[model samples]
Target: MTTEVSTRPLQTLLAFPFHEDRWQSKMLIGIGLTLAGMIIPIIPGLILMGYVYQIMHRVIVDRGSLYLPEWDNWGKFLKDGWRLFCVAFLYSLPTLVVSFAGMGIYIVTFIGAMTAAGNHPDSPASILLFVAIGILFLSIGLSILTGTLTFLVLPAALGHTVARDSFSAGFDFTGWWKIFRANTGGFLIALLVITGLMGLVYIVSQIFSMTIVLICLIVLLPLAVGFYVMLIGAALVAGAYREGVENLELAELKLAEASIVAVQEEKPS
Candidate 1:
């Protein structure tokens, strides 16, 4: 008998991080991403991100089991991590560029406004105050909206990249849109779940400072928590993407069966 695929988003989301089956191995991977790799004084954090990307790839495409990633393959982890970085960097670029450009424009215009106010005593002080307030509100509003959008679409986009095994796949708008449409609610919940988990990780790391020694806590707790958070994020995303992939597989299977039936009907009796 075939095993029932764990495609339910919420159940899939909880399984990787919390399931008793392979928790120890998962924790070891978290260490490799965080504390263990940091021993080399290189960008282990980035390498860890790549490692996380591989896990998402396995779940979304290979339908591989969700368990701890083996830490033995340093080279492979770094390469995959780099690919993940490239994809995410592309996703985040537009917001970064717009934010910088806006801030630059605001600074230049604010300086001009200040100069004008000084030169003309009749200038309304309220105008300067309004611009300051406007810029503040604008910056905050843009940040929130952009961040939410980026996070909301991230899992689907990343999943597509993994499914296709190419960086270019991340930009496949039509493909990712279908996946996103299939799992809208799952993606949203994954985003919320990930955001909260990250915050909790940070808080735990901070709390350790008071309860434990500073150097030891920093060396041990934070990086471990960071890696664990990364694992959880992957699980959450994989859960959402699983729905799309399973649907896609089912459709393809049905189409194949239909084609087979048509061929038989066309055969000479």
Candidate 2:
């Protein structure tokens, strides 16, 4: 029987730079293909997003570092994703409502502060400080909340079990301090690296003429980064779940295998 344990760290879904598995390479290519497909004008971005999740779901099931399904598989995966997307999207409705409310409050606070200070807005430094602080706090909170929502809803659409659970599961996972502590450092490091690379790309692209072509290319650079980061984030979460939540380490699997063999031999089989 196949063990349900997750694979090794170097072989996890994140497909980190050091990962040498063929599946990892294929998954990376798959992500690139999905992103390129998304950039097309007429096709709905949701279609491609669905495919990405489908591919990810298959990867998880295969227990491999990468998963590249055939073209037909892509179609089926997209359909499955669409079905799940509807459910997850509906589940996320409350989050969307709250987000809108938060934005409204944020805008209102800033406007009210400015209006209270009147034409001499520069005079009330305290008001300006309060407004700035509120904006910063709101932004940080939104960033974490949205990031958590992405983890909860997106993968479930792709076939992860958590998506089927109540909406509270998403908040619970995100609020779990142990999970945060385990994965936050790696994510921040990835963010800094990607940011630096994008910065360099932007600088190099700007060396060309300031025509529409250059501007569009510059815009595409960040989109490319954004797509990669999403995959990376998914991978990190997959890794965390495999180790922390599922408790399915490769070493434990090997030990179990050895134990099974010893037991069989002792049984006179």
Could you say which candidate leads in lDDT? 1
Task: Give the TM-score (vs. native) of candidate 1.
Answer: 0.74
- Cα RMSDs of all predictions? 5.6, 9.7
lDDT of 1 by residue, 85-116 (tens): 78888888777866776677677767877787
Q: Write the per-residue lDDT of candidate 2 for residues 96-198, one digit (tens) a residue.
A: 7566666677677767767667766566643754875577577658756875765444432323333332234434434343433444454344445445655
Clashes of each: 1, 1
- Measured with C-alpha atoms, the lDDT of residue 195 in candidate 2 is 51
For model 1, the local distance difference test gives: 0.76
lDDT of all predictions, in order shown? 0.76, 0.52
